[model samples]
Each structure stands twice: as structure tokens, then as C-alpha cells.
Target: MRRIKKTQIAEMLLEHQLITKEQLETAIAQQKTSDKKIGQILVDLGYVEENKFLELLARQLEIPFVDLKSYTLQPDLVKLLPEFYARHFRAIVLKREGDAYLIGMADPQNLLAYDEFERILKAKINTALIREDDLLTILDAMYRRSEEISHFAESLSAELKPSDIDIFSGTQDFSSDDMPVVNLLRSIFEDAVQINASDIHIEPGEKVLRIRLRVDGVLQEQIVEEKAITQALVQRVKLMSGLNIAEKRLPQDGRFSIKVKDKFLDVRVSTMPIQYGESVVMRLLDQSADILRLNQIGMPKEIFEYYSQLLTASYGLLLIVGPTGSGKTTTLYASLNELNKAEDKIITVEDPVEYRLPRINQVQVHSQIGLTFANVLRSVLRQDPDIIMIGELRDQETMEIALRSAMTGHLVLATLHTNDTISSMTRLLDMGAEGYLVASVLRAVIAQRLVRRICMKCITDATLSPPEITWLKSLKHNEYLNVNYKHGTGCTYCHRTGYLGRIGVYELLPMVPELADALRQQDSNKFQLLAEKQPLYRPLVLAGMDLATRGITTVQEIIRMSGEI
Candidate 1:
């Protein structure tokens, strides 16, 4: 055992402020029962954070910290060592264990480096082939963790006391009515922000109120409470959102903002009268507007470039069709970012504007105030805007307005609730927009969906099973195209789900004369067939298959998204 120097121990005692002359004598007397090192003792006594202890060690030992992610172990070197030795070194062989070369390292004697490497790898390792920079990060993280632990320990050593509680609080003051509605609404929004929720739903029932948050496009139940409390909460939200708190009978809408951490979030609030009570839905928008770019939105480079060119054309309607929560807003935002210019006047009318962009005018649809999509769009056209973005063309009036706008020299971009690009025209026509108008003004319709991306860190090539191969053979494929299957192995980087980000499967319809003529004749099937015959034809199914072949998305996801190719 290494004996600690008296001078070093005294310095540590002084650093922690844990001793005086009398306390030093007491510590010396108690030393027999405490075998911990000076750093460990200081940490146990809550004098410093654990990282601080590691930093002290680093300073004393004069060694560098290392991180594992920056390390790239060579396989050839590890082949010479046994498994036990390799495991002891906290390193892994980069190549196959059986016939391939391997690389190994010695033990992780540097505590700071070891801690950071473990965090990056999410596992225990004695050695790693780290780059010079990563090694420095490891050392820094070790010192940081030590400092944090030391501070925590110090806080814990402080005395604890119980506070007295009133058994019977005043009923009048304790009631929910006593709290301001705005305060309650602030709490709800704060909670939503903390949980990274995209939407909040407040469902009013006969006897109770249900609150749920949509996180990552999935709705999750957060809480349920009494109807009275729920009503109070609703009023609170309405007040914060700037809606009519006193008027509960008629439907109302509002907008508000809340600051969470260092970010400000824009919140759109809507309330509708139901038989039981008022139901509310609030869409949360991240104020930063940090959306993935056109290429990062998951479309292939060629398809992305093709659409980019179409948007630049002087006059045409570009429709993006997809089901709700399929990332249509993100795609539209990306396109707007592409087209936005200081010289051009661009305006948008949305039911609830999801994001705020600089240099673009955004209008919110207020149905209760008789300001609808059609009404706002008609007014927007008069504003002399070069580009108009409608949230959705739901009704005949809005569809007509969108078509006319595109025909009258202004570009229109909007979303429609449709299954695919081919069906979007049918949906528009079904809404009573003329087929001729659609064919003349419609430039392109892009239908898309998001599918999970493969985990690159753990993804390994595996031979397709016989059944899988047979299934691939069943799909319709062009003679010119070859299909290959690939997938990922679950890893820590992807939360053990084998997938990280999502890729988009897009179906783009370009307006060719023959296809326009087919649409004009009400020959949608023929139009689709003729479009397929074109040399540049690539449907949604083909796009999905291409992504699957590249191992970016799974075949199952493609099949689910494109519906059996």
C-alpha cells in the first residue's frame, strides 16, 4: 500500500476547509478506522466533487485524458493478445476475432480518461486507441465529474431538518380558484417544454379531464384529474394563450410563447365547445426553427435537386401531400428556406403557424372570427406577394383559390391530406377544383413519409434469409433496376433500436403535357400509367426501395409506408 505524504494530506485538508488544529488531532485519532485515500476521504466527507478529485490526480500524475469515440483501434495488434488481456485493457478488437488482425492496449490507469471513455462507449474498457484530442476530452471530463461529485458530497454533509406542516389549510385559499389561470397555464407549457413535447391535448370528459403530450409525433397520456381541477387548468391555459377565459360556450383560438431553459417556444392554442365541456389542443413550436435541410430531410440528392428546380419556376402550385404528423411541415419549411429571398414578397396563411421565419409574413386562420383559409388567401393574393404558402387545401374554396393563385402568376405551395402523389389530384378534384385548372397550374406533387435510419455504429452485413429473398422477389421491379437487401444490428448509439434518424420516401409527379392531358380527360389511372412510362419516372415505392437497398431504412418500413410497393 502507498502511504500518503503528510504535506499532501495537510494540503488536501486545507483545500477542503475540513480541519483546524483540534480537528486535525481528531482526524489523526480516527485514521485507524478510515483507510480511504485523501481524495476519497475528502469526497466521502462532501468536501469536493468527484471530478475535482480526478483533476487533482491528473495534475499530480501529469497524464492526459482520453475519450473512446475519437479512438480507432487497429485490429492487427489485438490478434497477438489473449481475450483476457484485451478485456483487461478496456479495448476491443476492430476486426473479426477469429481470423482477422486485432489491436490491444494496456490498462486504463488514467481515471479521467477511463471515465469519459466509459461514457462514450457506455461500457467498461481498460484500453482504447484514442486520438490526441479525445484523450484531452477524457481528462477534462474526468476533472469535471470529480468536481461535481465533490460539491455533491459537501452539500450532503450539511445538516438536514424537517419542516412543520399545517394539517388543516384554509379551504378558500387552498382552492384552485385562488391560483391565477395564467400561472397554471405557464406550468402546463413549462411541463410540455421540459418533456420536449410537440403537442398538448386537453380532453374534457364527463367527470374528469385528460391531459396528454405528443412527443416525437406520438401522443402519450400525462395526467388525469377531477373535472373541477381540469376546468381550472383549461382556464389557466386559455388565459396564458390569450383566449377568452370567461367565454366557455363558443370556440376560441389564441397564441402565446413560453421560455424554457434558454429557448423560447411558440405555442398555438385552440379550444372547441363539446357536449361535456371545452376541448383544447396546443401545438408547440420550437422557436429556433432548427429544421433539417432539404438533403437531410431524407429525400435522395437527385429527387431533392429536381424539386428544388421546380420551386424556382415562375408560376405553379407545388403540393406536398401526406397524412398528419408525417413531417409535411418540416418539408415545407425546408422548401421555404430554399426559396426565401429578400427581394421576393412571400406570405403564408396557416390554421396555426408552426414556425416563425424572418422576412416572411405569416397569417393565422381564425375560423371563429370568420377569417378562414379562403378568406385569408383571397386577401393574401391582393397583397402582391410573389409566393404564397397555404397550410392545407381542405375545402373547395381554398382549392379554387390555390389553383387560381398559381394560374395568375403567383407561386403557391401547400399541403393536402392525401395518400400519395398520384391520389393528390383526385383529392383536389374531389374537393371540386377543376381537373383542367389542376393540370394547367399544378407543377408537381410530392408525397412523403419518414422511416427510421439504420445505426451506423453497430450495423453489420448479414445474409438475407431465404424467406426474405423470396419476399423481395415478389415485389414488382423494373428490368433496369437490381434489388439488394440490407439491415442494421441494434447498438447503444441507436438506443438499442438499430435506428437513429428517419429517411423520407417521396413520390414526385412532374407536370408533363401527356400526363396533364390525361388528368384533363379525367383519366387518373391512364395518367399514372403514362407517368410511369416516362424515362424519369420514380414513384414513392421505388424511392422507398432505393432507401432500403442503401441500408438507410428497413424493408418493412418501406413496405408499410408505400403499401406493398
Candidate 2:
């Protein structure tokens, strides 16, 4: 038997805190009986936590304990680490392009090493296993020089400009000159997928071209350049959507698909000719956004619980009312996800299906084919759907059909363009939907708005001025409670805007017997009065005020959007 060093024994005892001499002796005795590692013996003898042992081992070995699960390794960084470290640590460098590196390592079974690595790196590492072939493919895909990849992206973008896009679409009829345009169109579609845009909008102005992308329900400007490039980009988009390039005078619609990031996204493109040039809107259908859970949406508990109950109901028209860009689609999509199951048949009629939901049949409303909202709703009824989701109820025909579907037993979830729940009813009445029908068939109406959240890192306590304090005090009858406004201190985390992300301020109109009776009698005044009296009925202004009171959002946001509390 080899003699263990006294210093090594002391260190182990000190580190493991096998503080008792008897426990250390027991561990030593156990190590002799078990072929298991000495560290295992100490751990089994109630010595130290597994992580602590691993941390010690990492310090002894002078190597990183990698947990690949939480951390993302850029491709360039992988190339910077020594190859010996990669091989010894059993890591495969997936991508080592230019200055970026993406590395994948085996599970960090050595807890000590992982702790040390975490302390040193200050970033979490995510771990996952990959096949050798897949790893090799990733490595091969890495560009030697980042500039090459960047330039290729730039060139593809250049070719996608409005003028070039126009030329390409114009020449797609198989003329020898049309080859460049065909190639250019293919390249732009490929690039659009890489950037993860939900929709692409190409609007032509008098002297400028604007390309906007709808990402996560908000429109973001992707590119703004000269008109020629914008036209080319539009033409390229039209060609991919399978529209006639020369038919720019009339509105055209088309769709195409591209594989990106190991997933397929459907892109729907719409173009209308404006005075300057053709305007285009491309809607990207990324399924991931639709798969979000209800809790992930960040609504307050009251609103979330209220909506949850409304959705579980068997039948009723649950209308999500909001202005454009208020995340109504996301809320509707989340509700559909909640209702979707193996047993139920869910059908949706979207002007164009924006996102694909698995296990649900989505019908696209084609105005050209006379497959408008009314036609689709009529057709969806025959499909035996348990739930029907109309994208938007623009006119009387669609509104009536949707209401009939809900009244007859189908759960209808849809969006309407309005400022609040009350306004939605008025708008529906103005659109030719009978007032009584609107009252009876309506289950609940949710009106929502987005307000920026105070950046946690830069949030500060601020004393409110007399006017602000007076307004806040007016919110409740109890003027005795002390309250102060929270404002952002401005930091890099919040882009110096003092806000990091947006939270939803929701107003839910819960359907009660009294409210339903008022709607049935076409009594708008009674309905409003009842709504105000309900404890759960939170108007948009009150919701905004609640958010401001909690310091989750600022008073100014509430004032600007929903008016003073």
C-alpha cells in the first residue's frame, strides 16, 4: 500500500471539513475497502458537498470544469483557446470563425472545476452532446475571416435594394438578362431567414426606400437607403413570393419559405404600388414566438388569472382589443396555445396566417379568391372546430359570422382595432354588428397597452411633486398611505433610456350576469355603470396607475398613454 502524504491528508480534511478525527479515519478506512475514488469515499462519509470537492479538484488539476448547459461560446473565442485545452477538456470547437468561437464540452461532472470556471469566466456555460458529424459540419461552416461573411451579407443586402429587386423581378420571365435577378431574389430570401425577422415591409417613398421587419410583434427598421436599392429589394421579394414582377400597378400577394437555424419559417409577402414605387410587406411566420407559455407574457396576476378563466370557458367571443402594435397578436396566440390540445379541433382564419400553431388548422383569407373573413368563417364552421380565431373583424359580415360562431357553441378568440373594451363594442355596432348580439355573445374583452419597465439596474427613488402626489392620492379614497414615484436612473443595461423591456398594462372586462343582461337589452349606459362597479373590472387607466404605483413603470408613461390617474 502506498503511503499518503500527511500534508495531502491535512488539506483534504481541512477542505472537506471531515472535522472529526473519527470521520477522517472512517473515510480513510472506507477508501481502503472501496475501489471508488478517494473523493467519493469522503463524499459518502458526509464530508463535503460534491461541488466543493469538484472545486478543489479543479484547483488541483489547473483545468476548467465546463458546464456547457447555460453558457454560449462565440465561434471566434474557441479558436483563441489552446488546442490542448480543447482535447484535454474533451471539448469540440464547433465554430472558429474570425474572432468568434463556439465550443461544446461534455458535462462538468467535476463540480470543483465548474465552480472555478464559473468564478473565472463570470458567464454561465451551457452543455449538450452533439454527434461527431454535426460538430464537424459546424466547424467547417465557420468562416476563416469574419470580413468575408460580413461582406457576403452586405453584398446580398445590396442586391436586395429596391431598384435591383425590381430589375430582378422584371427579368424573372427567363430572358437571358433575368438570371442575375433570379439569383439575387434567392439570396435575399436566404438572408431574411438568417436575421430572424417575423415580417419584412418594403414601403416606397417619394425619394427614399424603407425596409422594416416585424420582430416579436413590433416593427423595426432594418434598412433605410436610396430608392433604387429599395425597389430592387421589393422586386426580389415579389419574385420569391411568386408574384408577377411587371404587375406593380395592382396589389399582389405571395408566400415563400426558407430554412434557417435548423427551422423552417414561412414568409408571406404583400405589395401595393404607391405613387413613387411599389410598397411591400412581408410577414415572417416563426413558430417559436407562438409557443410561449402564459406566465412568460409578464402580465399582472389579476389579469393573468382573469384571462385564464375566460379561456377555459366552453364558448364565448373573447375579444382582445388594442391599438396596432400593442401585442394583441401575442396575447391571442398565447390563448390559442393554452386551449390547443390533442382532443380539440382549433381553426383560425387569418387575413394571412402570421404564425403557425401545431395541431391547429389555419386558413388564410385571400381577398382575390373571395376568401375574405366572412367566407373563411363560414367555411371554418363546417370544419367542426371547437374554437375559431379570426385574425381581425374588420367589417359587419366578419363580425356577425364570428359572433354567430361563438353563440352557436364554438369558442372564438380574435382581435379588434379599438382603444378599450367599451370602444370595441361601439366600433362593432358602428360596423353593422347589432348592439344586442354584441352584448349576448361577448364573453370578455381585454384591452392592453405596452409600457416600458424601469431598468432594475438603474432604478432610483424619486420624490413626487405636489401635482403628481395630489394626482396619485386621488387614486384611492385613503389619502393616508404614503406613496412615491420611481424613475429610471439611466444605465447601459437599459440603453440609457432607464427602461429595459415593456410590460403589459391590461384592462379586462369580465362577463357577469348583470353585464350580459345590459348588453342583451342594448343598454350601453347600464353596461358602463356595471363595469365601473365590478371589483375585477380594471379600466386601462387604472391598470396603468397600478403599474405606476408599484414602480414597475413610470407615471409619465401612464399620463402620456392613458392620461393622469
List per-prediction Cα lDDT, in the order shown. Answer: 0.65, 0.66
The digit string of per-residue lDDT tens for model 2 on 111-211 reads 44344434434455443233223333333333322223334334545544354445324543333334444554444445455444456676777655555
What is the C-alpha local distance difference test score of candidate 1? 0.65
Model 2 misplaced stretches (Cα beyond 4 Å): 1-227, 454-500, 563-565
Task: Quote the positional error of residue 335 for candidate 2 in Å.
Answer: 1.8
RMSD of each: 14.0, 11.2
For residue 330, model 1's alpha carbon misses the true position, in angstroms, by 1.7
At residue 125, give the lDDT of candidate 2. 47
* Per-residue error (Å), model 2, residue 358: 2.8
Clashes of each: 32, 39
Instruction: State model 2's lDDT.
Output: 0.66
